[model samples]
Each structure stands twice: as C-alpha cells, then as structure tokens.
Target: MAGQSKLSELFIKCKSENRAALIGYLPAGFPNQSDSIKIIKAMIEGGVDAVEIGFPYSDPVMDGPVIQEAAEVARNNGITMAKTLEIVKEISGTGVPTLLMTYWNPIEKYGPAKFAHDFSDSGMEGVITPDLPIEEAGVWLATAKENSIHSIFVVAPSTGDGRLKDVTSNCSGFIYAASSMGVTGTQTNVANTASILVERVRNVSGTPVAVGLGVSNRAQASEVAKFADGVIVGSAFVKAVLQNPSDPATAVRKVAEELALGVRER
Candidate 1:
C-alpha cells in the first residue's frame, strides 16, 4: 500500500477486502467551513476508501441542481481556492486517499503546475478533472506526473472505442464512468449503460472503473457493485449534507455507511 500510488493502494485494498471501493464526494465548503470538514471525516469513518473534494466553481455546467446548489452555498460562504486546499489537507490527514475533483478551467486560471504542487504539498493523492479532455491535457498530465499525482478521466457511454483507449491512456489511476448521459445527481435506478461502458473500458485498459453520476442509496450501490470496481456517491452525499446542514456530519456518516455496506455485498 505504501509503495503503490494512493489510488492504486485503494483499489488493491478494496480487492483484498473482496469488495469494490466506495468513493464519496462533497464540495469543499458546502454548508459551512467547519461542517464540511466534519462531513468528510464522517464519510471516511463510515467506509469510504477514497474521497473526492469538489472545488466549487460558479458555473458548474456539468453538475445537477443538487450539486450546483451546493456550489452556490460554498461560493456564497466565501470558499476560495485557499480554503479548498486547506480542507483537502485536513481530509488527507485522515489517511484516506483524497482527490480534488474540479473543472479544468479552474486549473487553467490557477496554473496547472502551481496547482499540482499545491495539491501534492497538501497531501492529496491525485485529482479528477471531469471536463479536461484527453486531447487538451498534455500539459496538465505532465504537471501531475511530475508531482506524482494520479490523473483520472471520465469515459462516457457515448465515447468511441478508439477514444476510450485514448482517454484511458491519459489516466494514471482509475476511470470514472458516468452511469448516465446526463449531469451528476441521484437516480431511482442505476443506469444499465454503465455496465456496457465499463466493459468497453476494460477491453482497452485494465485500470479499475468506478461508476458515478446517478448512484444514490444502498440498493443502487449494490447494483453498481456488480460491475464496477468502485461505486461513487456524489449528489446523494451532497444532498444529505445540504438537507441536514445543522447535523451534516451525521447525515453524511449515515449515507456513507449505507454505501459502504452496499459495496461489501459483492
């Protein structure tokens, strides 16, 4: 575990446990600064093998209403890049592999090299830039590689087989397979499209695949666990914290535990 990249260590740990990995996402500053950090720790304690801390952007074109609203709260509360790094550093200290999930535009404005160094310095394992296409990621990849940070790319259901290989080639950790075609949010049922996309990615790269975008409750997590190497719970966790802001940590903890149990069913 110490020898492998943190992301690799997570996959290896999950495999050894005979279960898929559980990844939970939360904006760096959702309800408030104090509650956000507490919520993340609660997530790890509940059973997340890894965490994705969202760097809230004003225009989150790829996010659903739940996540977009969370972004608004974070930004409105004065959550800046500095505050996000502070939160990342604290969460990384929990010994769970932590990755910053953000839009590529923020990295461009912050300078990829500078951002990579800050992330590494903050004890982050890596990053997941959902919007950074492989065609335009050469410099960012180089910067991340230089800092020993893993790069994860999204492999959509619509992606061609050739493009799937291209995207996987740029990925150093695992591939994030959006379960549905639309933006990120919870759905009543896990998308059947994810299994197909995962199979396609497997044909090209052996990297672990995590299904994201629609997973909500434990049953859905169990559904995705059948196919993916990991189950990513984002919008649901964000929604939990958003709904119970006064007790966000407990809300997040309960959801994380459910997702963790679901993954263990495999």
Candidate 2:
C-alpha cells in the first residue's frame, strides 16, 4: 500500500515511458450517471493515466465558468456525496487510478472519518481539496492517511519558498502547482509564467509536481511537461462533454487520445 499509494511514483512510472501523465477530469454525473461511467471508461481506454472525479459543490469558488456550470448540472441531476462514492467503486473496477476532486464542506457533512474509511473501501486512491489549506489539512489528513489515501496539496505561483516547502512536506501524493493565481478554465499563453512556477515548485519539493488550471490544449500541455512530471487537464474536457453529452464517451476518447499523444510526443 505504501508504494502503491504514492502519486510521485506513479508519475515517475509514466515519465520513464517518455510520456507525461494525462489526467482527465469530469464532474460525476455530468450529463447523468450513465454517461459519467461511459466517459470514465472512454478515458481509460483512450490512454489516460488517471482520472479526477469531481464531486458537485453548489459553490465551487476556485473553478471557473465551464467547471462551475458542469457542477451545477451534476448537482441538479441529484448527484450527491453518496452517489459519488458509488461511482468511485464502479470506476475502480475499470482498473484506472482515480482521485476525488472535492470541497471540504461535503466531507465535513459526511463526517471525515466515515468518509475517508468508506471512500478508501470504495477504491479511491486519493483526494484533492484546493480549499483545504495546509494548516486546516490536519482536520481530515489523518483520517485520509489512515486509509492509505494520499492527501494532495496545492501550491500556487504566488507561494513563496517557505510556504511551498511547508505544503510539499505535508503532501503524500504529487503536489499541484497551479499555473496561475486564478480559477480553473481556459487561458491564453501562460508558458512563461508556467515555466517559472514549475521551476520554483520543483526546487522546493522532492514530490512530483503536476501543473493544472487553465491548460486547454496539446501545445500548452507539451510546454508544461517540459518543466513538470504530470499535466492535469480538466475544464477543456468537461466543456467538450457538456457540448455533446449524448455521446460524451466519444468526446472523452478523442480528447484523451489527443492529450495522451501530445504528452507522449514531448
């Protein structure tokens, strides 16, 4: 469990193949539960290294328009914490590593200990809560760690060396280095800023660093991989599915393949 649960080792495995990991993100129950499973399976078949299953939260402050809209639709479709857990089990059966992307409120609502135990039992590998700060991570970190679930931490471009080291030290999985100091979504030409941020984070932490937030294309992903071990693409894929939910599996496959190739080409 120790070696199997660490995200950095997973990233290194992907790196050894001369390919950056392609992490796909989708809101659980996006178009509906049926479609969500289809998309997850599509991503796995299309070569995605991992998947980030988003739990719908009414107010996802850090997510931008695309993800925010998808979350709203998921919540409207009656997607709840319990439903997400069930989805985790289904996805796990597909043999692709999965992480739950969520907020703190829902975990608290479900009781941290119970949530962690149940989630681990259901086959989730880890969790990413951008809103959970280093100081407050202690609130749920222990429960998560007890179940061998990695607690993913986020470090922003604005984070100084001291805070960066502190956050990375507490991180068991790969550290997410936000490409910018803003919400998740599309952005124009972030190469320069991304390079500096990646170097800063790499210098501070031995953990594998993943670059996320505002990455939308192959070109951008390739550029980011030059400085980091993994690339996390979310909004672009979610927006693609929302555009054609009836056949989201196809869209997921297409995007996943494209991104996978993009990273592998690097």
The 0-to-1 C-alpha lDDT of every candidate, in the order given, reads 0.88, 0.83
lDDT of 2 by residue, 17-91 (tens): 876787888889886787788888888787788888999899899999999998988888889888898899998
Candidate 1 CA-lDDT value: 0.88
Query: Of the candidates shown, which would achieve the greatest lDDT relative to the real structure?
Result: 1
Query: Candidate 2 local accuracy as lDDT?
Result: 0.83
Worst 10 residues of 1 by lDDT: 1-10
Candidate 1 residue lDDT tens string, 1-266? 22387778889888888888999999998877887898899989888889999999988888999999999998999898889999999999888889999999888998999999998899887789888898899899888888988888888888998889999888877889988788999464565888888889999998899999999888888888888899998999988987886787888899999999999886
Q: Which stretches of candidate 2 lie over 4 Å from their true place?
A: 6-9
Q: Which candidate number has the best TM-score? A: 1
